[model samples]
Target: MDIDDEVVIIGAGICGLATALALHRKGINNVVMERSETLRNTTGAAIGIRQNGWRALDQLGVAETLRRTAILIHRDRTVSLDDGKVHEILMKGEFRCLRRKDLIDTLYDELPSTTVKFGCQLESIKLDPNTSKPVLRFSDGSAILAKVLIGCDGGKSIVADFLNVKPTKKFSFCAVRGLSNYPNGHSFDHDFVRITKDNKFLGIIPIDDHSEDEKKEAVMDVDDEVVIIGAGICGLATALALHKKGIKSVVMERSESLRNTTGSAIGIRQNGWRALDQLGVAETLRHTAIAIQRERIVSLADGKVEEIPMKGETRCLRRKDLIDTLYDALPPATVKFGCQLESIKLDQITTKPVLRFIDGSSIIAKVVIGCDGGKSIVADFLNLKPTKMFSICGVRGLSNYRDGHSFAHEFLRIRKDNKLVGRLPIDEHLVYWFCAHPYVPGDERNWEDPEEIRRSTLDLLSDYPKEIQEMIEITDVKTLSFSHLRYRAPWDLLMGTFCKGTVTIAGDAMHVMGPFLGQGGSAGLEDAIVLARNLAQMGSIHVESRRKVTVQGVEEAFNLYVKQRKMRVIRLSLQTYLTGMLLGASSHLKKLLCIVLLFLLFRNPSGHIDYDCGCL
Candidate 1:
């Protein structure tokens, strides 16, 4: 476990090996550790390298070798997959499709003997107290101390944790690339082709003639029967529900990992618990958070308090726990991380939904479910108008008191001067709280940092109880977040269509409402259960007949899902809208209107949480 190396690299992919080689040329000793038994060639069959890439290869002394075996691309074409529109552009610079194995092999061959240590998996990294150097611990229980560490370990790198780097933002699309052989000469010109429609894209590049006239291409795979976009709570839950019914689905998430920890916590009531129970993760998740017994409403003006008993099972869970539990319940490889959806369109021949990703890859699915959130690209494909934002914004975070506090296990809400502050205990030592207020023009100028947010929140509550002030002041800044609330208009949900062909939407993509009702998370869970139930019934029919899911059959199922969910979501949206109006209304007339509507439509405020989404 003792080493004299000055630098260490954790990966032997193209980047890791290339970095080590660069360091070697600079007279720096470095070791590249690869967990794989050999170099990876599964990335793709070939890569299209342009002029800059060739220059980089030249610096590494591999350009000439690659040039000898790669075909030059001279022309470029952009084709619209939707409308059959084609535009051809003349090529200018150097571009070629070299086999990825060729490049990887060349890099590996050029490296010094024994430079890469295979089968070394990095388990943990900590700083040496004496030398201030990084001490890397491998899974084999060996440790190495190095002066510097470089992470070229692909996207989900463990080394990233050592640097405290924020996770990369997830996009809405992913890619697929492969090598296709054409023993018979292909008619394609010595040019590259870029095909696209909406957010979808495809690229085709030819390899050298000596390589069996092979071409690197990105095309849609027609084998995917069910494709769910997003790996959030709704997406994973839906996938799990389907899996429970013997229906397999691919959950495509743009993020490299599970749900973002920044979502803080989510309150799951009876309906959400029902959905989780049906998904087979409820029992395990229940131990993560304590259940609520009652809701305590406090009025700041008169120090008055009112309590309402919480009826059914209700618990506040760390969003990470819920997402992790749901994900862990499913079979391996069921969720495909980094598969961001770019565009989706109906195939002219089969009429099935074809989804394209930003990574130049695509897949055709018999049924496409959009569990993507408020800014859903799938909803856009359905031509649904975007959700509207409210003038009110919420600042939320977690407050931890290491020394256990003596607070009741109750959901507390306090209101004064049109501003509302709410707090609920996550456990004996942790609490989740939120402050919502009207949007003041340029007020965010003071809320830039966590300290600033804390300061502003404290100032806003200066006249309130001292306990509240102390809680806000001592909150951990990393958990602080502020954003405006947005919701789909109630009217839109009533009259708008939620299904097109065999594609449909769920969760926030379907019915996004304000937090007034606290039903957003539960509603999405309900969506997963209901949607899976309908699909299971439909899939059972197909299984009995030994036939594939037809477009008409899928469409019928989606229509039924919409039919069952439409009015319920509309009612939920309307209630949240009215509640927001009651709090943020600028004039007396609007306030009266909202109050009247609330009383007429919702006789009981907590009635929304009483219903169940049924079993999977």
Candidate 2:
């Protein structure tokens, strides 16, 4: 086919579309020639639309529409990496980091529907001898004779070649940019920041408020160096641990917001306290709970009592407090909530782990850490066996004494017929209590209702002391929860692989164990500290064209993490397993063996709490 146009713009990118739109506004008929079958979508990251840029958009009658999509930049700051110096200037006019897609889509929508011609790859161009017009020949064996040829065809323009223009120069360094979305809002000032070291540069511009829906759309195919798959204590702590070492990571959480906030509390022994201190949150969290001075053990069957002095710092913290503290300590956009991971596979080209979410969005990460609990998708990707369940389930809740109870700063454990219930004060007015008992045949159905869980727990513990019963009765129904105790076998941790390529597991995902020894949360925190330490030792992380830590570097860091944490967690897991076994054992021989093993392995039950994970 042959066509004739008064004005033809090559390329359908921002320049070509804007040009076409300008010509359309002046009532000058024009057409745009796009080589690909569809508009360019993934060619660029973000464009800093400055004052003149907005003015051009205003002239084209589209500035007002684009203004609503992004935040305004109030200041521009330049950071020099050589001497660690900084220069600042207040922006005189409007500035923003406008997404390329937003601009391209806006321009395309403003133009006439028939203005763009897709699948039109230009082959050559020549001057028509008779009319002196430019003749455009396409690879599809078609031609167009236009009075004017505007070459907006990006870097390699055929029209520019025909005009004998100087070719574009190639540079040694490349630039790649992306937008980081903060669903809960960002803490950065409305500034456009540029950090430069020699020829390398990084730009950070504040965009508009990112909502949940927009966050899901904006990070569809983004790439990150490190991606932590859960936002719980372990995941967020790991991110913060890395952040403490000046490393950035993306935390993908499945929930809409922070979860497990009911009434569950984590006992932070000396080890967990050491990890929190390394993450720089220990001082703040310590004021939230009272310190335990001693422990009390009571036998309901024989009315036998025992007391032991606590050797180190120990406190019970609400799970919500820990989660919120860790989350608030991280930078903006570090954690992306509502991101349900669908599956994970290694990319064929880069061998990096590619995470696919249920929303059809995916991310390619240089390092993937599975902190998504025992049933982690990343662990499944690593082909680790699913965590096995114990014969018991645990029910936990928080009780409030309006008048402030008269209990001392002590942990009390009462046991009878394989049923154990413990209570510890979080503060003067709130008490954290839990019960671990044999799993009933139909206890799974009670998981959805807190009332049923409370009732079942009360029924199971009916033979306990009256004060314990009263504490359970005063507990808030909303804080009641029933969960099956699940753990990865100690032998599995010894023989099975916890890491493959640049992927590894942490927290409950790597070593979930019974809470009898009170090491699950602490062990996870330790995992965070140790993992971050190993990774930071590789080298400084830079957001340049490529990551500093290559595939081999990631593997080496993960191997070190697993190697350091393997025996430590194996010992912890084995102790917790034997504790559960001793409580649930039916035969006298089995019980005796568990007792003998516990005596042999850990002469001091609280000795594990003394080990420190070291500084970040």
Candidate 3:
């Protein structure tokens, strides 16, 4: 059987579905092919919603929905673990978190149900070289013809295969996530958390409320409860974007929740803040989040601290608070608590792309977006391999004290040894901290054992001020987490040619970098919005219009996506790496250089940090 349309979409994940919604809003009707028989209830734990993602959601008319479900996070606080000295940084806006499913569901709600054809696995496409129309055949023996096709199928996209496109895996970092109930009256400020210990790192994001009242309140109500991975801040922001879109997401971890461990916090830059604002969660974030005004570097030998005020606006958010806001904004159906993607394969030939599940069922889609994270299937399918640009380690956690205890007001601190430490306020009663150091190969101690990790971390910080030790001592092993840090270069051969025919990639699929600059999810969301707009402007999907839909058009758009993104992503990645390097510097000369650089660059209070959203 054969059908015709103006366009055919190959996946139904975030990018795919968002593209569909965008097209539909533009009055472009098309068939959305999915490999799965039903909408996926479980995706990943959480994702960061930077300005780009929020802009896309705003175009979709669901920014309010997302805001309703997400908690606004706006400030960044960093402090010395030894002296309780603080530095504060302020932001133009903030970010939030939501479960993966919540975001998916919200996007799904905005589309026509009949537009998505499930269980139709793409087998192969016979492109009429003369007209450029694609004849799609599915594993289920279904067929269709379309003037244009969009792969939005994710990093492991068959469309990329058909087009012979591949992405280079820039880095490989596995993450574990979980969620838990926030104790009643917990009163933790709504914020995202980041912490570092020795060279290990962990992050915590608060999600929507877990109870009935939370379930019924506006998605933005701070009561929504959920937690995400203990890794970094990007994933948590992605989750917030989804929830703001009115989808419900839950982050299920292999281990216990971050509340049970120590976590890290990071500063949210304007790039990410724009994402939260576009989603309409910026107001809430601005109210409860902490502002980071400066970053200080202390000389280990002389105990002299040099202060550099932040040039641009930034916020320090508790990781958990960001996650909880996203969780609250989403629909409950959005997330699958314990489900994991074991394996994936593409149908050889099909009008619609098909994904075979390990559960013995198959999913057919117009596209499959792989937000499955760093070790993404979409990235693998595109043949993207991880690159080793920078490798490091980090440790992090939260510490509790009396309500009146005064701590550092700033958000980030670097030592003469180049070790980096930061603190974020979760509430008046608690503070989160993190540490980062250069990776030393062969340092294999079980990091999962909180006790062992804590002992090692404290020993490493022994040279720090006594206040830092006091905080560490008061913080039990149960409140700490650890992990290695790795990053990839922004531009890669694979990302240069990310799309083939109807398939394309987004998020970590195209570019994966270190989390220091916090633009990972921000970039992905930008990709989604740009791709959606391009597809919307392409018009109908019918065979008659196929000739008018030139390969040049698709190529041009894809190229533009890459060109607009490359420099920005590269700059952010490099900035993050530089921050890490400066923190981990070993030599006196290097430390002095860092100080000089800080004074030269960061000393200016009027300096501006610009990030282009590529909306133009």
Candidate 4:
């Protein structure tokens, strides 16, 4: 096989496609081989596109298209799904919500049609035993030779397999997702919504047309729409942020769609907001979100109801509306409808990554970002392990009543066993409720079964006030969702070695954390942005040494990438772990201590951490 190009890409997911576009921008037209028979569309809905992600999209010339379909949410409000009470928090500036399809379609459109080959599954790599150049063989018996290959294939990648890279299983967390149609007369207060019970978290997102009805009609658009995400809030928020940056995205869920469950009302702290603002989607979000002036904390056991004025600003927005806005902002091709990543491989000799599909096909790419989540295949391929922290389990849902609901509020009703319940108001029509309980590791309780989890949650909260108990009694089990909390260690040798040749990891693959600090998706987007920038800046000559183009430059660049991202990711992972520990404090004394410490340190000044990387 004769080498014909400078680079070859495997897979066509966000990472692969984004890398292709980046290379294209650098005047490099690489071949993108996808194993699927067609573009994938079934991977599920919405992902967070942070400021960093937005910057990359902007640089790729898809920002404006994304903005047109996305909803910019400046605020997040937490409300009691049971009591209709609200607690509002302001995000500095961040756009939330874009459908997965919208984002993929947009990226696809940017590439020259000739660059992508659909249904070209990689069978094996034929290395030039003498020269070491890589030859990629396809299932169809055709082959192409390339100087450099990138494994953008996901976890379980064949590219990684060929290179003999094995990823370690960190934690066992599986996610189920579903989408709901927009309801009539829905009052959406924030762009993103979150409800936490013990160790579980549920996120709701709003999706809508950015243009007014009349304008949409004038533009011959379809009816306004929104998506409800039942996964962890961080994942949902990441998708939302991407839309805020003007990248369209969509989410397809595995479970039955819950059409009647209204979107969530959650608050966004300063840390999340600042990241959004830097991404250039903050202005639009501010227009529709509610700013929080104070946070009211109510503890039933202590009879302590304190109204603490918010030091730094916080905002609230309706979750569904945010998703709708993000969807509207993105180009149609940005997301695929049902593409699931089954397996992946990283090929070092040929230097291109490959992905093996469940359907018996494959795709190859330059880089693979593991935003596929905690039990990520990419993480597994990289041999990264997760360190077990405490496990949390909880139930969440929306309630119909909405009287005396503040936009931003947190009611901590401490019952037996230190169980806590929180309520947030998304709008006048609905509230988001959460109940959390501690659990030991290896507990086999099924959190996804709403009826069972609801019963257990109610049992835990039975000793609370009559009002609280009444709210739980009347809650709808059909609308409820559950989650378990887990954390990955700050540093792992496997992740450090993920980039053997042309393969790398990102998002949850590198670090999966509990949703304590709300930085999960934000951090992942940051990774994508940073990696894209580094790859974009490196020239072909710079990527390869003159004397041994195949031997030196590529390895140097890959090594540099690992070094640059390691410290930052490790810092975030540690921060997330510490934050989760503080939030999940089981002892009453510990809770009191934490509350007092928070009041003393977090009241006068914004307690939010800044996200300035100071890197291009």
How much is 143 displaced in model 2, in angstroms?
A: 81
User: What tens-digit string does per-residue lDDT give for candidate 3 at 1-616?
Assistant: 3445567999888888888988999998877898865575465767768667777788899888877876766655554454556555653454777767678878888888788887567878878777677878876455777788898777777788888777646446666776554423234555555555544446666665344454333122111222222112333343444344332224322222222112444456666666556545557766656666676766677778878776555776655555545444545534433333344444467443344333223334333334445565555665666645454677877676754338656654646354666665555656677777677777778888878877887888888878777777766354578868656554453255555443345565556665555566556555444543354344112244221222345455555655665665565555555555566666778767766765665563222245545331
> What's the true lDDT of residue 27 in model 1?
86
What are the per-residue Cα lDDT tens digits for candidate 2 across 1-616?
Answer: 2346458989999999999999999999998999875677545767889899999999999999899888998888999998899999999888888877678888999998999998688989998899887889986557888888899998898988999999989988787877565544567888888999988898888767655665566444444448899998899999998887767788999875567464478788989999999999999999999999999999989999999998789999988789889988999889987688989988898776778877556787877889998888888898888889998889999888877888889999999989999899999988999999887666456477888877877788888878898999988666688788898999988887989988898999999898898999999999999998888786335655333455666788888889999999999999999999998887999999999999999998878888889888
Residue 438 miss distance in model 3 (angstroms): 2.7
Best by lDDT: 2
- For model 1, what is the error of residue 523's alpha carbon versus the real structure, in angstroms, after optimal superposition? 0.4
Q: Provide the lowest-lDDT 10-residue window in model 3.
A: 221-230
What is the TM-score of each predicted model, taking all chains together?
0.67, 0.65, 0.52, 0.50
Candidate 3 achieves a global lDDT of: 0.58
Model 4, span 1-616: residue lDDT tens? 4556658888988888889999999998687888864455446777766677788889999989988776777667665665566777776555667777778878988999877777677877767787778888876557877789998888757778778788746566667776553322235654577765555657777765322343323321111111111222333333444343332234322222211233244455665456455444556666655565665656666677767666554555554444444444445533433444566665556545565433233455443444556666666666666545455655677554524343344323343344657665444545567776676567576766777766777777777777666666656454577766666776563345655554455566567676555455556546544544444345122323221112244356556767876776666666555545555776778767766655554463333345543333
TM for candidate 4 is 0.50
The reply for model 1, stretches above 4 Å from the true place, is 1-216, 441-449, 539-548
Ranking by lDDT: 2, 1, 3, 4
> Positional deviation of 453 in candidate 2, in angstroms?
1.4
Error of 2 at 273 (Å): 0.4
Candidate lDDT scores, in order, read 0.82, 0.85, 0.58, 0.57
**Model 2 CA lDDT for position 583:** 87
